[model samples]
Target: MKYIVKLNFEVDGSVDKPDVIGAIFGQTENLFGQEFDLRELQDKGRLGRIIVDIKNKGGKIEGYIEIPSNLDRVETVLIASMVESVEKVGPYNAKFELKEIEDVRAEKLKKIIDRAKEILTTWTKEKNLDIKEVINEISGAVKTGEIIEFGPERLPAGPDVYSDPNLIIVEGRADIINLLRYGYKNTVAVEGASGKIPHSVVELSKSKKTVIAFLDGDHGGDMILKDLINANVKIDFVARAPVGREVEELTGKEIAKSLSNMVPFSQYLKKQQESTISVQPRVESVITEAKEQQAVQVIEQPRKEIEIKIPSTVMEEIKKLPGTLEGIIFDETWNPVERVQVRDIISKLETITNGNASFIIFDGVITQRLLELAASKNVKLVVGVRIGGINKKPENVKILTLADVIGP
Candidate 1:
């Protein structure tokens, strides 16, 4: 059962409904302790939303308030009395008069009676549907049933992944489901941004007639593709989800459109390199200026270097790494913690909190975004293949390049 407390109030000067409601809560907070606190009552579903209707006239305000309460009569009456005792709304003096307490159960019963007939009529009509609905349901079940776990990783794949000569590699399990819905029976998912590409996927790619890496149209997708390349997976063609879209969310027509526009992997990489080279000079200038400023600051106050010796074996391993866009995080003891594609480095840093990682070494350009993330995680040093332009240098985090540390 619910009770509606009808209230009438007048403010000396104009005030809004929020001001009046806030005054009620603030004035009555400590009057009855935790049990009867307005916020607690509302949170426990003992109080319904407060409704206020106010009008301004000649710089004064008048309003009618409605508060529905599920509390017992005695408790609700106590609450009403508390609201009536509110002395002000904002800076304006106010007077609240409790007009009446109304039992709302009767009104709710009437509403339920009125709605029952309409609902019954709609339900009767819907009970008589055509066989088309059943057929569609069966068809959907069949399509979803065609999905299978392809390999040891239990990655989502279409039933024909092993049988089909060509393969489509997509970003995740959802992408596989979406492709299966569109009758593409040779699709498989890479799962997630795992440091190593799934061994099953790599072996399968090598066996297919042509492996198409179908990726989302986002930085994360680009990073996954880079990881695939760095893992030496044989990818022939690359298809991208439409700009600002994801594979799982695309319509059937969109999926077809993107597949039709697939480009050779080599051509795609060349285009990306050209774009990076075009911006290189300006980025280099910014880096040089930032380095010069850093040098000035260092000369002003000489600081001791906290060096962690790198083993020659590890240096050789880093040199043998395949791609230019990879990274590894090291603990304070010079032990490797995590390896990630460069584009995903920022995301990796954000997941691990301060004191977990001390050093980061990557074969990619380091930018200001990377520096800020490293600084937040209290990383001591970042060594990249090249350092990109940064407007401001973060204190306490040292940025260097492989050339600066291990020499070219």
Candidate 2:
């Protein structure tokens, strides 16, 4: 037998050993009110339970249960009520029922769980589930903390990038960084060669505003473009770096000139189909300019490779990470785009945004301050390469993927 009993108690400080044990027994004793002596039950161990925490924050009580795997259903529920009462605060309460099915013949257990779920749903509807989380509060300040208000599954930062009347799709986070470094801003990534093109992209392109699929020149990149085209992605062009070079490898000038000459997908496909058309060499001056524009590639020596200041925004993002911001990038069309380096990000900032303006980025974790600042600055998109969420993405703002700003 498992008593599906719960222990809920609000504590001033974070939960400690004493509070845990006390809540368990207090709830258990209340459940058995007169059936057995509290001391006797503890001694016998027949009606005993143990504290198993569910959630905790800054010593304040979060979630936990006492399993009376030794008690019956009625006792468990009675114990649960005591827990709920203990965990209650300002009319808000904590809840989850005790449940046990030793042999799996648990029709009764299922019904109990179902009802408990129903109750929980109702309770959530009536209250702010995140009353504990507020601006500048402990929960909000815990960077990389295991937050439970839900994460990426529920929201992807602020605004969806593809919803813009005109949008660019890149491969992955590195791509986002590069573009962010230069300043294209309205973009998102597919993260890899997978996933249905997001509905936001489909709808925007359907209205005829043009979706540009900026991808790598590799086989995987070609495959992704083909997939999007085949799936009827309403894309207008395919922008790519020179063969064997990704956007990440381009110089600031290379990045600017590429955008300056983006060809529509229709024209690209047409050019590919024309066998009679020869590669027309532009005037010699053009060729010379291209060569001149080729960014100087520096090889590392024993001395530190040109130390440059990472954008304050990028620095802040890295500092707040739970782990390294290392990952492959993909385009919005779901293709392997490129690999990014932490060093490149730092270099790109100094190389591109040099003498431009104050280079700072918003984390986009909350609304108001950052959102207002972005709006006032005419910032159309906020590219968060590491964090993919914002408290809100206001109407004037378009949140982009890391890759969209960098590239595959």
Candidate 3:
């Protein structure tokens, strides 16, 4: 019973709503006879009023007419056609066009359906979902993706460890992951104290950048620090978690506090030594002299060479990598494990664990510190474009040059 007629009209001169309505009634009268007259239908409540909206612009009026009807479909169509027959309104020559005839009940039903769909979508989302938990899961996945492996041992490390100017060495992969979660990207893990210090870490320390040993607050952390020192890894600073706390479990504020409280490695070591034993004044002098002699000898000695066979595939990769500033790590079976930038090779090595790489071919100079690191990781062969001045070469590691493999 509910029907809406949409009519569009244009008039040559300004006209108001009363003017438009009066014209429709006056023109349509008697044409349909008195039985279907709009005035009689409206008076008896069989039809609603005719509504007109008009706007005057540049001396021309344009607007729409809305007529709600309770008449049958046939009567409604006839009345709409009559409305289009309106040729003049007030003093303006005008033309009316029937835009559409819509069933208001159908539109109301459509709205109900649309609202139901919206409610269902909201309910489904809330059925078994926690907004905070979903966010945490996504964030955790992103953090995990940022972790990478380094060296033959497959040490776990953060991506920024290689790119950042400074580094923080933690005790294990968990500590590295925790630091990464808190937005600390320049972090690597030593894994454990059972094996030698990873060659990647040793070589990285020799780059003369500040390296912090951030360890747990227990006896094990102290042991790890001692082991790193014994292996000749150059640690610049030491940061420790609060007593009874591990690096992996520290809160963000605690982590910041611990790093801020870091002490110089030399100062910390001297303090520890003083607390345990009486020091002779000459001990410092002797240590200083020994360090100076070691530095001098490294510069003066000729690099020793050992005969080692190079695989053809490794040689091919090395050839492709030269001038690219890249390094390729190969597994025990001579398969490529990872390729990294030469500047990041040390940090990359410190991250891998589980004997992930057995050989490394690079387009760079092989330094003494790199040789020691490669040996500690049990990497068997090191191939590069050239060898730098090496004070001493570690056993079990064979160094080769591109000239050595290709035969100058």
* The best candidate in terms of lDDT: 1
Q: If candidate 3 were superposed on the true structure by all CA atoms, what would the RMSD be?
A: 22.6
lDDT of each: 0.78, 0.47, 0.76
- The superposed Cα distance between candidate 1 and the true structure at residue 47, in angstroms, equals 63
Superposition error at 27 for model 1 (Å): 78
Q: For model 2, what is the C-alpha lDDT against the true structure?
A: 0.47
Worst 10 residues of 1 by lDDT: 278-287
lDDT tens per residue, model 2, 82-120: 445444233334343334323223656798999999999
- Alpha carbon deviation, residue 195, candidate 1 (Å): 2.2
On the 0 to 100 scale, the lDDT of residue 93 in model 2 is 41
RMSD of model 1 against the true structure: 16.2
Q: Which is better, 1 or 3, measured by TM-score?
A: 1
- Which ten contiguous residues of candidate 2 have the minimum total lDDT? 149-158
Candidate 1 shows a clash count of 0
What TM-score would every model get versus the actual structure? Answer: 0.36, 0.31, 0.35
lDDT tens digits, residue span 1-408, model 3: 489989999999987888889999999998979988999999988788788888889989999988899988899999999989989998779999999999999999999999999999998986967564456435643676688887666777889877888989987665765677678889888876443688888887788678999977754465567668767888899999887456765656789999999999888868767787322333344345446755765674446334456677666666675445468888888888888856568778888783777888875657666787788888888987655435566757777876677643
The TM-score obtained by model 1 is 0.36
Off by over 4 Å in 2: 1-164, 275-408
Candidate 3 TM-score, C-alpha based: 0.35
Per-residue lDDT tens digits for candidate 1, residues 225-259, read 76687678899999998764667656677888999
